[model samples]
Target chain A: MEKKKTTIILFSGDYDKAMAAYIIANGAAAYDHEVTIFHTFWGLNALRKDENIEVKKGFMEKMFAKMMPRGADKMGLSKMHFAGMGPKMIKDVMKKHNAVPLPQLIEMAQEQDIKLVACTMTMDLLGLKEVELLDNIEYAGVAAYLADAEDGNVNLFI
Target chain B: MEKKKTTIILFSGDYDKAMAAYIIANGAAAYDHEVTIFHTFWGLNALRKDENIEVKKGFMEKMFAKMMPRGADKMGLSKMHFAGMGPKMIKDVMKKHNAVPLPQLIEMAQEQDIKLVACTMTMDLLGLKEVELLDNIEYAGVAAYLADAEDGNVNLFI
Candidate 1:
């Protein structure tokens, strides 16, 4: 069978959504297909090893955060403060569920020849220097993502 | 404790997403919180009592359609076209799942006093007349969704 190339343009600033992109892109890799994920805006946070992700919280956010054991970790809320139930719950879930960290997932994608692109505009707007970002990301402009998107691959906004 | 209201924007034109929105809104209603689902774009398609959702070909998107069930229906690419394996899988998995249907979920939200807002911009773009939509949908614009989302409440876009 002839191999088909499909690129996915994921646009999202939401932490939970960035996590979703990682999951979906990883799943695509398992299928032995060419997968490219474009991360922009809020998505850039996922590529950082720095603990800077911040999800705004109020009474409900705090209350809701407590009820869920794994909190944002299991719920795919990457930007959640202290991961809902804090680092312990997140570590526990990661071990028990075999959930891969976002960074590790990117590594796996790289091993599988998956192309990872980061939006340059978002980086500039957010004041993210190349030195600040992780090693695996490719910086580009709208034309880069749009070119892939127009190829009829897949354009997704998370 | 004072009760807070949140606007949950459900931007789905797909059958399954509409269904997910209804179920999620229903879940939020269980918390006795006010929920508003703003349906716009392709999401308007689900409100129509007519037409079947399609799940496109390809294993991943189809599997996603089958797994998510509601989000994929809008594509109209049911798995049945493939010797019945796909559709049957979708049905079997759906049986064990407990998500509410789009219509019923909407009713549950309304009965529980959850607000429903439909996007007028999307309606115009899709050439959908107000009469073509479901009865409970309140049509508005981006300004409306933003206005509702402004209250520092839990905001979700599904």
Candidate 2:
């Protein structure tokens, strides 16, 4: 029998939203499913390396890069932001509950061999360069995403 | 052959995100796939009735009801909110492009027989009553969502 396939389109930059996506993906992978997270738009911020990488860029690209979060740890919460207090509070609660952080979750996903693909189109639009993102991730477009999703048992756009 | 299934977890309350969810759901329905949109968390705001419906509620619930958008039209954008300018700008662009608004896309989904489900758990947490939401929609929990999603050809959390 073929393994079940799960494809998720991570489209949000929110810390909580990305956590939810990663949690679900990790759970699905634990169930022995072939999981893929196609990071797009703001979601690609989760794959960033948390440091500025000097690269040539136009004004708009530079603006976008400066405005967007540098990495998953820098992402804000989707709700109750409360002037940047929410993420800190959630982090405290997560630590108390022994829950893994978003960065660790991504590491686990990688260790489990879950495929992580960054959307090349959004990369250009957002001005994110290959060197700025984490290593060992594939880059592709919507056509490749649709190909994975069309045959997927579980396809989610997060 | 069994019909292909598409299930979405509409978890965001943003106007643009909800529009994306409805558009995808409507498209899947048009393709003859059985589709379900499980509205959870802030996503339930889309199903709210435009008019105020007086209902008994605790303090927290009342606060939730008051803070959340009354309906789809009242919801804000996820990005570039610009102190309420974003939604208006997007609506203007949508009008210029002859693009369907989120509310109409929802109506199209219903007409195409796409199942719209409100997550009962979140509804209760948010203090939303049955009379407050649009008519002809189903109310269910995560179990039902999982049942549909486990075999879903396309499952999205938008």
* lDDT of all predictions: 0.55, 0.87
- On residues A1-158, what C-alpha lDDT tens digit does candidate 1 reach at each position? 53434455555543334444565566555655456788776566556545333445566544533443221233333222343432343344444446565556667787887888878887666555565556766889889877765543223456
Worst 10 residues of 2 chain A by lDDT: A89-98
Residue-by-residue lDDT tens digits, candidate 2, A8-54: 89999988778767866787788777889999999999999998899
Ten residues in sequence with the least summed lDDT for candidate 1 chain B: B70-79
Give the fraction of reference interface contacts each candidate recovers.
0.00, 0.46
Q: Which stretches of candidate 1 lie over 4 Å from their true place?
A: A1-157, B51-88, B96-99
List TM-scores for all candidates, in order.
Answer: 0.43, 0.63
DockQ of each candidate, alpha-carbon based: 0.03, 0.26
Error of 2 at A119 (Å): 1.8
Model 1, A97: alpha-carbon shift in Å?
50
